[model samples]
Target: MIFIHPTAEVSDKAKIGDGTKIWHHAQIRENAEIGENCNIGKGVYIDFGVKIGNNCKIQNYVSVYHGVVIEDDVFIGPSVTFTNDLYPRAFIWSEEKVSKTLIKKGASIGANSTLICGITIGKFALIGAGSVVTKDVPDYALVYGNPAKITCFVCECGRKLENFEDNKKDNLVKGICKFCKKEIFINKNNFKKWKK
Candidate 1:
């Protein structure tokens, strides 16, 4: 059972899966495919041809532009903006100018963040509030700040992994969650570009 509010504008060409709920004044554009049990908050804008996977939660007034793909169980907080173009000119608009952004499964982006195009946000990565993500984020990374540097690695439960930063000397590091005691192995080479 999909519920689209009376004020929402969902195009007939869009494919929305079962149990999805679109809130008031949200706009789902043509060819956008949203998977099952997703919650699209009020005033959200999902651009044409964007694909969102199952059980995702998109908060109010978030703008998911064209060329962005969101995988399952992703959480996008309020007013998060996704950019599709590297260069912006008011008069210059073309599909060729659009760069793709991929948000891997189980990633959580904090409120008011801006994700630049052509970057892949890795699985279970946590992006802090008001961050400006300019490049690819490694899996299980906890990234924040302008240009979004990796501060540490986090567990799947969103808890900071113990001793991740202290053990960065090796090419491969093991991160253990203090709360959940789950071990996650991460390759430090993946973070070479953003290393401190």
Candidate 2:
């Protein structure tokens, strides 16, 4: 049930799951694995051996380069950039030199954000627009800065749970999401989804 646009170039070796739609002018490379119910937007380029999990939305003009792994239920906003090389040189073509990036499940990457390689963006994290992520983001973190600092903790539905700026050290705050009614617990070191 995969729908590939007529102008799209999908390799025969790529594994596209059911209910996925690849839009116009998109290119899916060999050995790429895309899971079910995903949207690959126009002019998007999925590099060889890149893995994308189920229920994902990758918007227009996104460059999912090699060594990037996207987990299920992720939202990648328009024009997001993923870089693979730590020190890129035009003359050097080394596959082993490229660093890996992992976007965990239920995470949302805002538009025009740049994710540097060798970082694992944790589950349910929200990355704000135009951010340049240089390090690993914790789960349920609301991060937005030039280097992407954790400003707050948020629920899975994108509601801010607690402010880290107001309370910096060793304390716990419990919050209930207004939209989804999910309970969240935030401490100095972790953000947890609590069920009671």
Candidate 3:
């Protein structure tokens, strides 16, 4: 039961899973694989060979370039741009120069963000609007800003955690969500890697 809008250009070589809907003017390139029950909004561009997992929502005009892999339950907001090349020259382009990006399951990327290539966005991470993510983000991190830094850790429900404390013995940072009352733990080493 996949639905593709009449104005959308979906290549026959692309594989769209069941219950997916591609909206007006969207383009899904050759060999791209979009998993089940995904919503691709108007004017979105999914580049060749890109892989998107199940139940993802990609908002209008978002550009997912080649070599980007998005896991299940990801939310990519409007106008988000994913880059595949570290160096860009109009006349110098080759597939070998394309760097890969991995957005782990359950991550939310806010509107108008730009993600540089070769970075792995961790599971359940929340990226704020207008962010420019230049490096890897830790799991459950809340990141925002020009070079998106981890401000805090969030619960799986996307609620900010409170009463953050580090346990030196185990090298873990622990926080509890006020709303969900869920205990979240992040490895100290991984937290330190992106805390800047």
Q: Judge candidate 2 against the unseen true structure and give its global Cα lDDT, from 0 to 1.
A: 0.90
lDDT tens string, model 3, 29-63? 99999999999999999999999999999999999
Residue lDDT tens for model 1, 20-65: 9999999999999999999999999999999999999999999999
- As a whole number from 0 to 100, the lDDT of residue 35 in candidate 3 is 100
Error (Å) of candidate 3 at residue 68 is 0.2
Query: Which candidate, 1 or 2, has the higher lDDT?
Result: 1
Per-candidate local distance difference test: 0.94, 0.90, 0.96
Error of 3 at 81 (Å): 0.2
The collision pairs in model 3 are: none
| TM-score to true structure, per model | 0.93, 0.89, 0.95
**Residue 6 error, candidate 1, Å:** 0.7
Regions of model 1 farther than 4 Å from truth: 164-171, 191-195
Model 1 scores a C-alpha lDDT of 0.94
> Among these predicted structures, which one has the highest lDDT?
3
- Candidate 3 regions with alpha-carbon error over 4 angstroms: 165-169, 193-196
The Cα error of candidate 2 at residue 41, in Å, is 0.2
TM-score of 3: 0.95
- Per-prediction tally of clashes: 0, 0, 0
